[model samples]
Target: MALNLFSRKQAEAPPAIEAATLRSDRFRLERQSDWQRLESIVTALEKNRPGRIADDDLLELPVLYRKAASSLAVARETSLDAATLAYLESLVRRAWFQVYGPRTGFLRWLRSFFGGGWSAAVRDLWLDICIALAVMVAGTLVGWLLVAGDNEWYYRLVPDSMAGGRHPGASPEMLAQSLEGTEGAEGLTVFAASLFSNNSGVCILAFALGFAFGIPTLLLLVHNMAMLGAMLWLFHQGGLGFDFAAWLSVHGTTELFAILLAGAAGLHIGRSMAFPGELSIMDAAAASGRRAAVVMVGCVLMLVIAGLLEGYARQLVQTSEARLTIGLVMLAFWLAYFLLMPRRAMGAKVDPA
Candidate 1:
């Protein structure tokens, strides 16, 4: 009885091993042609040596990848031999990249962004921009009126550190000197860094606080511009309003514009969530977030430009005319670029740009 049991066990093991070997061989033979073709195409693509792959092979890449992926799944379920499973996996990975991976390099993506992608995105948010602009204007007026109604309001609106010696009822001489870029080279460098940090913080915060229907973003914008209004009223009272305006404009043109875009971007996300329309809230938010993110990237670049203008150019050029010229030129350039660049790239008329 023991001898019979041993013979039966040995016989069963041989049959099982033969079945597995046969399955692996059959699987390979059935898909071997596709696997080879996919491997060739993937190799050519990886080399980035264009014109090496035939047009037909390029078109068939996706199909071949899907087939290989399917085979991998089957091989695992059937417990195919290790070598065959490994080959399928390797082939599938290489083929998958050629079929679906990103083909655009960094340069290509950068060109696309600055060329028209950014401006087009901005155009889409024009409505939000208008709304944000209106709210900012209103906030500025509120600050000005508050301070005008009571001088004490200026202190409340403007921090002592920022106000320095320039405050309500400050003599015109001191206020004028303040605008003359009296800060030395080292001081200007430090001031520029500080301005960039502060401005960037406000812009990012405005953009990041869009989830609660954008109320916080709106409030933040109002509060931020209120400080500007207070300072403006103070300068005007000392009869240095025009000088202060020119000073602020030099960098404020770019800095304020960046803040405007940030507020708009935040509003867009909140608006999408508030009114998802045909899509679910999550879907609407996801789509709007993508669009808003593009706008925010451009805003960051604008803020950096603003920082350089404020920190260096504004401090170096003491003349009001020169400051105004620089500010207006920057403003005009931004308006034209955002309004015209995309149309020009698309071969459209440049009217109103």
Candidate 2:
């Protein structure tokens, strides 16, 4: 009797296992169509390309996503096969990202960046800016003293290509004529193009070389300031210092500020890398890069304005008083925009990376 009972129980075990397998198979077959539909919708949304989905699919996406989430919950409770549970969980997670992830249009991003992002970034890098300015000022003082001691030092500091016929030996009359645009239309065009190109290169280099501990950026700033000082000294010897000052001021205000900002951006990155504090070096660097990039974009825009002023206003606006007025007005406008503009609270949400 015991042996017969054992045989019967063993025979019943196979049918019970078969029944459980059939039930799971039925469950999967019943839900497979919905799962596939949900997956297709999610894939389309994830890719973010236009025209891959139909209008009805768009409407059905949220509905199907919810259904998938429900199915996942039911699967977990009922102890469905691991493979089916995993697919549902992954599909739901992906759909969740599409539904709730950061969403900013390009125009909105531009508005936010120009409206407040750039100024905020500049404000945050105040220490770096002051350091950069100090370096430039120190360079200027050195160049001026060097040139005063020896006229030949001007040649060493100021390249001939950059000097553009204005040097220590240039007569006052020649300096005045040069300022009056006696160089003709073609010459003015060429001069403006050359100036913009040269300055742009310097600005780019200052920002690009910050990764090397900011040493190169400092040197570039000093070199730029030295050239300015040498040029100023040259004009002073020719008794045209005031005139040259006014001429340069028209665009130099904007141009110099842009270059300084670029240097500050580079210095920010270098500082973050060197002194990462509690954060990992990579994390700190990434945060600093984002902030610096905002400032650099504004720097480029400033350079464009400077180029326009130099190319057009400096050439045509002959009177020193008019040029000074334009320069001062522009300086004031930029100062107000950057320093006085209303800002959001520090805790307010900012744009996502």
Per-residue lDDT tens digits for candidate 1, residues 143-199, read 999999998998888998899899877789888877887546777777888899999
TM-score computed on alpha carbons, candidate 1: 0.81
Which candidate tops lDDT?
1
**Predicted structure 2, TM vs. truth:** 0.72
Clashing pairs in 2: none
RMSD of 2: 10.4
lDDT of 2 by residue, 1-353 (tens): 22234334434556656665466567767877887877877787778863888888878887887888898898899886556677778888887766655456778777777677778888889999999999989988888889999989998998887777877777888878878733345556666777778778888899988887788899989988988888888778888888888898899899999999999999988888889999998888888887888889888888888987898888888788888888888888888878976653222233332
Lowest summed lDDT across 10 adjacent residues in model 1 is found at 344-353
Q: How high is the lDDT of residue 328 in model 2?
A: 85
Model 1: per-residue Cα lDDT at residue 288: 88
Write down the lDDT of every candidate, Cα atoms only. Answer: 0.84, 0.80
